[model samples]
Target: MPVTSVTTDTEALTLTVVADFPVPVERLWGAFADPRKLERFWGPPGYPATFDRYELRPGGIAHYWMTSPEGERFYGRWDFSEIEEPDRIVVLDSFADAEGEIDTSVPSGRMTLLFESTATGSRLTAVSESPTLEALEQVLAMGQAEGMREAFGQLDVVLAELREYALGKGTVTEVLDDTHVRITRAFEAPRHLLWRAHTEPELMRKWLLGPGGWEMTACENDFVVGGSYRNAWAPVGDTVGEPFGFDGENLVIDPERRIVTTERMTGAPFPANVNDLSFDEDGGITLLTLIISFPDVAQRDMVLATGMTTGMEASYQRLESEILASV
Candidate 1:
């Protein structure tokens, strides 16, 4: 759900990032206010960050080091300039060394995080400004964009678990019928935004990968009655194997209301699958009811036996952090 978008303005020497989250302004603010939580997703997926200093106001400094999978560590620090509660924060960011000294020889950027309250959730836009065009290019060349994207996806997972724990509600899953698999989950985001998350291919791709190390390389959705769609995904690392694929036909589409679709794993051993999804909105939350069907009870049980619910639940939980939450 760490779906982050970065736009570089060459003329202005800034890297602008915009993201959405389905939580209250204060909750989202906590991610930065708490050093422990910030380290959870501050670095890229394979690199876990450790913090030494934590500060939340002007003239304060925050320092951290990100350890790579191979045990190599990289340091970074931020000097806060301004802090507006549940609103915005501005800071000067720079690279650092093992001793926690800022690397002035390297590029430095001024970063700003802007927050806004929405009908269903909150929006955050981050701007990183480099002193020169060359410095901006240096940061981009260092894979900042891709790193931020991956880091945010991991952030999505963390936010969901944190919310559940804070609310004293463990993620609950229920089976409504034998042939019909029903899953109900509530989101802080509005119904319309949640509907777009289900319908839009770009948005859907972010949270569709149920677990880590899997990437949706291809997602093509026609988004209309009788239209066909295809999704392809596979192990992200050096796994030498062809990706798996799923192609389906849209049986019905009623924008923000309902959708029925038929799905089949390209080379799977089971029969095709059918699904009916309904969206209901009350107050500011959207309740998604998913009912899946199979050819028969045997096939339905077989699908369940394959441990589908666990992955589906993970995906839905991540969806809460991805959808309009990251818009």
Candidate 2:
């Protein structure tokens, strides 16, 4: 993680966060100056932010919202008070409603962001000052520190151009928290086609086979909200593994944009895990992000230890070569 420290001073009614990045001060500053790049990592792993309005000049206002896994949106606004090129930015931050109306029920704070050159690259110091110590404590109790850590962890991909950073990196997995794991992979294909490859049974049978010597025997997909899907695989002639399958229900679906499902081994006794998958396309390439929420930390670790990452990479490679190539 880029964030090195997060400190809170009750007497001073301030919270400070310091993060170091391997990019220059200007480049790091551009991440915030540009709304597109800023939204890419503005929220934590599962929640994604969308900037509806962004004006960086002094006295301007920026409105944004982060959509939760269950489709709930939380709105926020920033009132710019000062800006000093690549060095400093001061804003008043507060909660807002869907219509961008300030929510007075929540405490607002003054935030100052400082950018400076570091030995390695650049450092960002963000300080948030509350009107009262109680307000500072309230914000900390809402997981502000941990949320910033997770949000900063996503900056590397944003700082580096998406394609330049992600393309050809078969499958990368990061443990966001004890129960949440995020997996990402980039494909040289359009977003809609990639969505079809995952939803259509015939197309899925061609590449969803995790490893060699196995064939997808049965694929039944309802492909709708509240729909259930079942997939089974059996080893071919010389394969050593036994037959296994999985069943899942679709919790949310948004065509080529997102899909949330609860999956579990067909007959296993363990609880089902929620898989939140999202797709982003740029310049003919699509980036697939899947965030899995396990029932507990034990379940998350156990699944990861089963060579899931390697298997997924193999499957993705097959997907690109077999299903996507002929399309």
Identify the leading candidate in terms of TM-score: 2
Q: Candidate 2's residue-wise lDDT over 86-171, tens digit each? A: 99999999989988888998899999999999999999998989998888888889887777777877887777666787898789
Over 4 Å off in model 1, which ranges? Answer: 2-4, 161-327
Q: Candidate 2's C-alpha lDDT? A: 0.89
Model 1 clash count equals 5
Question: Model 2: which ten-residue window has the lowest total lDDT?
Answer: 156-165
lDDT computed for candidate 1 = 0.75
What is the C-alpha lDDT profile of model 1 across 1-327, one tens digit per residue? 535577889999988877778878787887778886787668864465778998888999998987652346799999999999989999989999877689989977899988888787877788889999999899899998778766765555445543353222323445545666655566777778888888778787888886667888889988777789999989888755568888889876656756778889888877887776766554465656566776778887877786776777677777876665566
What does each candidate score in C-alpha RMSD?
17.5, 2.5
Q: What is the lDDT of residue 93 in candidate 1?
A: 94
Kindly report which residue pairs in candidate 1 clash with one another: 2-152, 2-153, 20-325, 20-326, 21-325
